[model samples]
Target chain A: MELDPKRYAGKRLLRREIPLSTTALREALQHQYFKQIPTLRKEKNILYCNRCNATQPHLQNINCQNCGSTHLYCRNCIQMGRVSYCEFFYEWAGPNPDWHIHNNPCAWEGELTKHQQIAADAIDQTMKQNGKLLVHAVCGAGKTEMLFQGIATSLQQGKRICLATPRADVVRELLPRFQQAFPTVTVQALYGGSPDKTGDGQLILATTHQLLRFYHAFDVLIIDEIDAFPFHADPMLHVASEKAKKQTCASIFLTATPRQKEKRQIAAKTLPHVFVPVRFHGQPLPVPASKLCFGLHKQLRKGTLPKGLLRWLHNRRNPTRQVLVFLPTVVLADRLQEEAIEVLLPFTQKILPKRETETLIRTVHAADKDREAKVQAFRNRETAIILTTTILERGVTFPSVDVAILDAAHDVFDEAALVQIAGRAGRSPADPTGEVVFFHEGRSDAMDKAVRAIQVMNRRAKRL
Target chain B: MNLCVGCGEAYTSRPSWSTFFWPERISLLCKDCEGSFHRLKDSGCPSCMKQIGSSICSDCLKWEKTSYQGVLEKNVSLYSYEPFMQDYIARWKYRGDYVLGKVFEVEFQKLYYQHFQDTKYEVVPIPLSAERMAERGFNQAGELAAFTRAKRKDVLGRKHGEKQSKRSRLHRLTAENPFQLLSEPPQYAVLIDDIYTTGTTLRHAAQVLQENGTDFVAAFTLIRG
Candidate 1:
């Protein structure tokens, strides 16, 4: 006897916000909430995450490797809240997000490129006609600006929008820009420790992990950096992104480098995509030149750098020109930093005897406690040479910095990562040209493809 | 899909929320691991519920012979201290994983309510020493007591002493009672603890509770070795 489905329309309530406690909720349902249905459905015993609708399958059991039972916990999204079988989640039987017409809500004044405008038009068509669209833009192609038009169109039509990315870092970086652009819209940024819990926003910016909390929640879902780490790797996140959106929602995936599988999908016409091949500055991406400097491991063992590498560092590093040396792993980066310090101390002392040379050299990796501070210091030109791993490969910019990779042939350096690392150089318009050198034992296909990709982009830009 | 909380494996046979009889929620552990533990049978010593081959266990007989003969009543236990349970308790107790308490919460609460449904039995969880409480961040017995229907009364406190697990058998049997009554005692009270190692701690607690007041005192524990 559900006579009025329209009564519950437009009210969006989380499952937990209805009643004070589970017992109270049970009583309310039994006595008051319904009038027609006499019998109750069997209550579920298993726990569902109120924040991230993680069911039994998404949760991992954590037991002691032995016979211990006390250490049992859920492994899926444990970084957020732990949702176990004992935990209870009330159902979301509230109204949907409030939708109202707002005139030109976006406040950003930047103009999209001709290529970006075409892609943005395709995106707007995807939102209106309803289908998934892939924005396969190159790094530094002003992809964020391309999204504003479609987002503004959707906002003007009074649609609930969510822009989710894989990493919290991207969400943090985009939060302020989105807030500044949509000054009239109520935008909520949802992350792990985000203080904004009220789901009364017209626009939502969240990490993809936070999307698990939503159910058929958005009219337009845009996932930026969709091909990035943790999101592309974990199937749980894929399921979450699918579960968080409406059935007829327009899904837009933004990525700089599309993987082979995605490329196949685009080639098959199964995933309609637009490519922005040129960067915003209208310059071709800097193609990395390979210089064979074999026996980096042997040099570390012998407590010295290769002669070619030493000469390159001597010629390349200076106060005005910063250098970023990419190592295969953090451990090797640390070891090379130590060994290079021991070997370069006498040389630096002979070259510049007055200044403290240690301040000129530093190392940063994923696990460094002062990674942000160290990166900021390097950006401020307080440090000249920052030896790092692939952690700084993408989403981080160092203007006019020379890049070098020690083991460019390693399996870890894929074509896309190599492309991104190479894109780091020559980013600033003030210094439009910078050097990117790859020192490897032997040439790799990834290296060849990276160089070929840059040359092809340059060729494409020349034709334009 | 149902996942085993102990091993993190997926099971597709049944829905996760389907319960059998009571509102005890769902089983967190999978089938294979769930079989490793068994509920305690009521076939042994009536006093401490130990599954000895005789009507009265040697430990309970020794208790009868001592001056603390009528100091305590029969103690009820929910589960047997099998090898698997031993390791689970060690990790839960020593490792300080509070979530592990959920595994036994529903079952323990159901059993407690079934036993004392009509009685006005006041439930008192054995209090930890202030030092141990701070170190563990929570009391294990108190956490288990949270699931029970009976109102919990924090009436017993303990003085600082060496850990019971570190002491030898004779030392534990003859250990000085560290428990003291925190308030005026209830007439019929039930003491709760995580385990009944030798029944010395419970007996000592019951002795102090009896000295402070009125009547009979039984004990309920999660496991009995």
Candidate 2:
């Protein structure tokens, strides 16, 4: 129970840090945490992703990535000015190039490609019609630049706009760019660390909770990373997003992994779509080397790891590139990190990679505010390995990285998750090929599906 | 007694027709009683909270006509506006001045409060709308009502009304009711406005409260003229 400060008006309020036993925590968890939130089921829809070259379907009530289409379909066309890439063409086509006409969210500030111009033009038309728009561009497709023109046009027209992202890392990266573009407009970046100043600026970038204080405040709403984190999983956030939009306002959505329902809608031809099949840099998609590691439960029970896996871990402890291990549960993750150190560190020169030569792994989750900084350290090649969950799935992209999942058959390792895991590898042009190991006692259907989806995307890009 | 002379006018019941022509013929308007009477204000348009020359504000073309006919009303603020009203509101609302509210409520019973009995009270505490309640912490009207022993029925919840600050004077509908009923409608009630310079809040409250079940409705503030 919270102490009521009003009851003891004259007494200075002192908040003490209360200590609790695990049993008490567990009891509270059983009662409070387990209480089911009301599930508001919505119709499922389809969305098509040119980056992955696949049309997937998921809940229609989810936030939209292109023009904020909560109800999505996979079919997309890049109209106006667009530069077509063979890889992107294989999944979806772009509009013919026109040099004279201009549009919002110019694909290129100095150099305009055909597909880039096409995507910009489509956004122009959507804004003109006052219709909601969704732009499902590739992760590195320069999605932010594609929105600059749209934002400027909306603001020029006296419309209030807000851009929301689930990841603070993404928000931090985009804040400077927004500030530079609209110097006079009160540009605010809201995350776990701050409050809403959206009113100060016609244009604002905020996380979902910062969205709570607003109701019917915006003329145009842009949701970045539409399928990331709590936005995809939490219902209260979804309601808040809808509440923020004005009755006549349009919404825009952007995401890499459009859930299943989005794919179906595109196939049905009910929702209009636009796709940029290639990355702005136009690099080929990454292809991974998958290995089948079996009998994990048997080895764990025996308190030993396979010789081949042990040797592999030993060689990967390098000075330049670090390794990332993603596990399902915190208990398993901590235990594995401990066991790996005992087996591999003493055999190497840097006994621990950076932190501990003997046990060089650490567990990271979304709950930790230091997650982004820690992951940045790993990317900078400071730590040998960082253990994490699905938190690094989509918004985070690392170059030429190797990924290992211990239990590929676990329920959490679904088709979309495995695709995201595979996407983490080969993000950079230099490192287009990497090793992806699914270490498990048995191969699961989800794993097989992920492998197939990646193969299909790569093959389609190659043929084009 | 010559002490009864107010300012410079002689205190006389009636004067000759020729004396009625000058200052001596004018009615006895004492400086203190006149000040109190002038403090009896009914001059604002509730929707915009603007002080207009006439009763109707520019924003609200229509008035919220209540079911009950005219019972004259004015601001029942604890003191007069400007010179006196400011201190009264501050003490009654802020600096633990329970006596200000109590004295105002008691004085209110002598003038406006006597018209309605307990049965006639469709007592509504001037709603602070949930949004405003969160900011200010407590409702000032509710506190005043407690001092006056006004009925504390939960029937008058704010029903999607625009804020008094944002609206224009003509925007106020003396008839547009915002109060909602939590229970079955009562038969008769008078709305309570803390400061009735503009009748928008009271009209809105009366419109809403009266719709549910109220037959007769009037308004009372702690110190209305």
Supply candidate 2's per-residue lDDT for A312.
63
Pairs that collide in candidate 1 are A10-A96, A11-A94, A11-A95, A11-A96, A12-A95, A61-B5, A61-B8
- lDDT string, candidate 2, B1-225, tens digits: 111112323344444775466543334433453354333344554432345565555434433243422322322343345634555455434332222343344455445455565655655667767755532334667755655565556566775556664566667534365666667655666556676545667765665655555666666565332
Predicted structure with the largest lDDT when compared to the true one = 1
**Candidate 2 chain A lDDT trough over 10 residues, lowest sum:** A9-18
* Model 2 C-alpha RMSD to native: 27.9
Computed on alpha carbons, the lDDT of every model, listed in order, comes to: 0.74, 0.55
Tens-place lDDT digits, model 1, residues B1-225: 666655566654444444655434777777876788888887878778888874878888888899788887878899999878887787667755555677887889889987777567988888889878644546888876776868778888899999988888799988899998888888888889999988889889999989888498889899997
- By TM-score, the best candidate is 1
Docking class of 1: incorrect
Question: In candidate 1, how many Å is residue A153 off?
Answer: 1.0
Write the residue-wise lDDT of candidate 1 on A1-464 in tens digits: 22122222322233333334657556644644422221112228765444444554453343331222432344455444433333333334433435877898889997777888999899988988758999988877878788888888998888888998876556666778888998988888888667875555778888888776566677899988776777887777887788778778999999877888898999899998998888777777878888887686676555456777677766764425677888877767766777777655544443334566767678898778787688877877766677888878876666768888888888889888898889888877677677798888888999999899878878877797
